[model samples]
Target: MLRNGQILFLCALALLTLGVLMVTSAGMQIDQASAEQPILVDGGLSPIAIMSGRTGMYAALAIGVMGAMAFVPQRLVERAIKPRPGRFYLMLGVGAAALLGLLLLVYLPGIAREKNFSSRWIEIPAPVFGTLSIQPSEIVKWSMLGLLAWCAVSAGDRLRLFWRGLVPMLIVLGLVCAVIMKEDLGTAVLIGAVGVIVLLAAGAKVWHIGVLAPAATPKPVVDRLNAAINKLLALPDVKTKLDRIGVVPMPETPAEFNKRIQE
Candidate 1:
């Protein structure tokens, strides 16, 4: 039988697989709709075909990353970060610089617009590379996790202190969340959640975690709520929700209903 952790990992893997399949299906539909008639006639594939190829490439990359993590000497990882604390800081600095560069690229001229919004994507002249994009928020998530973990471990027994251990984490997490909130609220919430998990794992006091409860509750839930609100506000069904919320009554006249719907 698999251990509990292994079972949980497998379950997560299954969910990820299902999500990938759904994404691929959606991509295929989008590709089919956008394909050129000549390509369809000649049996050439569309964007989905290209995406499928890229998915394979990404899978290989994921495998390679996992292999490297698995085979990397534990002693080396420890020595690299532990013995030379400067190395950890260097890695953190490099990651932060990369994230800043990505953020700046989002505002740079000649970058292709995504959905009429500024998103950080490296634009190459070639058509095939035009769509290549990277979200700095994702890197921020991992960086925060790594930095928090390092802080916790490096603090050693001092991590037991509420101030010495938790304050720094709270500060770092706050800064990261602020940066992420500029363009990506969802990622900010996710990174904060992971940071909290790492803190709890690092032997944080229950009360310390409890102290964060009120603050934590809003981050993830509020982001989702805001997104849903924005979507609803953009839709014709918003009046229905408003009526449900006791803001207004349902209109009786067709014209009035249509007018309210347009609001």
Candidate 2:
């Protein structure tokens, strides 16, 4: 039987596999077209060549991330935040400062243009490395988790009082939400959900958990709606099953109807 941690790991692995498969499927046509083309170009290969290189780079990043996570000692993480009262406050302050720095970096002159109206990533120019990109929201999510966990553990006896324990958490959560909303609403929702989960695990009240639970589900629908709206806004041909909606002389097969619609 797998332990709880092992089960969670397997589930994450499965999800990662599914995501990669989806990406591959989406790129399949382009990948095939590229593969059929000549190998060399003036300075570099075609756009397909660049994409093939990126695919390998992405795979390497995934492997490196997993390897780092697997080898890193849990004790080192724990020690970094060392269960001390003042240190927790210090860490929270540091996290806040780092978040602020990211925000400023995203808005700065040259960097702001690179963001394309979405201030979620920072492009750093490096001499030898060309350019490096960082996502501030990802850092903020992890930081919020650690900070909330610290708050929960510290609140201990004080957790009995709703005001003392809950207030601090709410304040931190609001700050994080505000920052993330400026850049990416989707990331904000995800960070908020994770923060709430960490709070619940830290022994937050049942009512609090109930209040936060519903916030997680609607965002997925909102995201889908936004994507649809964007597609429509772009003035692309709107293709939908609705075009065939009950408009057959004799009832046509579903597959046949779909093929006909495409035609």
Candidate 3:
């Protein structure tokens, strides 16, 4: 059996491969200006390439970033939320400050680069990567997610408290969202939604945000819903019989396994 971590890694690698393929394929174009030129002359780039072109650079960068993350020191991550006695809890502030500073970079003089009618990127002239346009909002969105997880873990018993745990998280979440919302409303809302989910997972009560139980459905509406469900179950589709006990035999796996075992 594959370990959970290995399974997750395999799934992520597959997704990354698919994304690179799609992105590179999107760059395909025809020479409409030339009558002699063929359509999609070179076909397209492969799923993985190393700094061959724009898409190649993106693929390489993606692999490099993922590899860097995968190889991060376990102790460094542990020390972020847990430290020995008498040691300073510096990672929390450093992390928050770093994220905040990155967010603020979008407004910096000569560094700010605008896209989609908003100043959300900072263009840095990288050596091999040409002009590397860094979107601070994107960085902040991903980085702060891990930051939120660390905060939630470190909070422990305090994570359940309104003022000490949830409030602080909400404040940080609000601040990040408020910043990103100015540049990109969609990303801000996404960050807010995911942040709220993390907080909730960390044991923040739904009532902490003033949520109440939904009112009971009307009897007529409930009856209609039940009827619809029953009708769905009565359909001729294979999934329809899920309401009743049924076996779905997937024989391919067993066949392959048996063949391998015999071989």
Q: How many angstroms is residue 222 displaced in model 2 relative to the true structure, after the best TM-score fit?
A: 27
The C-alpha stretches of model 1 lying farther than 4 A from their native spots are 1-22, 30-52, 67-74, 81-105, 108-131, 206-263
Query: Model 2: per-residue lDDT, tens digit, 15-42?
Result: 7656655665555443233656743322
* Alpha-carbon runs more than 4 Å astray in model 2: 1-52, 65-78, 114-116, 126-130, 160-163, 206-263
Winning model by lDDT? 3
**TM-score of candidate 2 versus the correct structure, residues matched by position:** 0.54
RMSD of each: 13.1, 14.5, 14.8
Candidates, ranked, TM-score:
3, 2, 1
Question: What would the TM-scores of all predictions be?
Answer: 0.53, 0.54, 0.64
Report the alpha-carbon TM-score of model 3 versus the true structure. Answer: 0.64
lDDT of each: 0.56, 0.58, 0.66
110-137 per-residue lDDT for model 1 (tens digits): 8644544736444545454335555556
- Candidate order, lDDT descending: 3, 2, 1
Candidate 2 has its poorest 10 consecutive residues by lDDT at 240-249
Tell me how candidate 2 scores on lDDT: 0.58
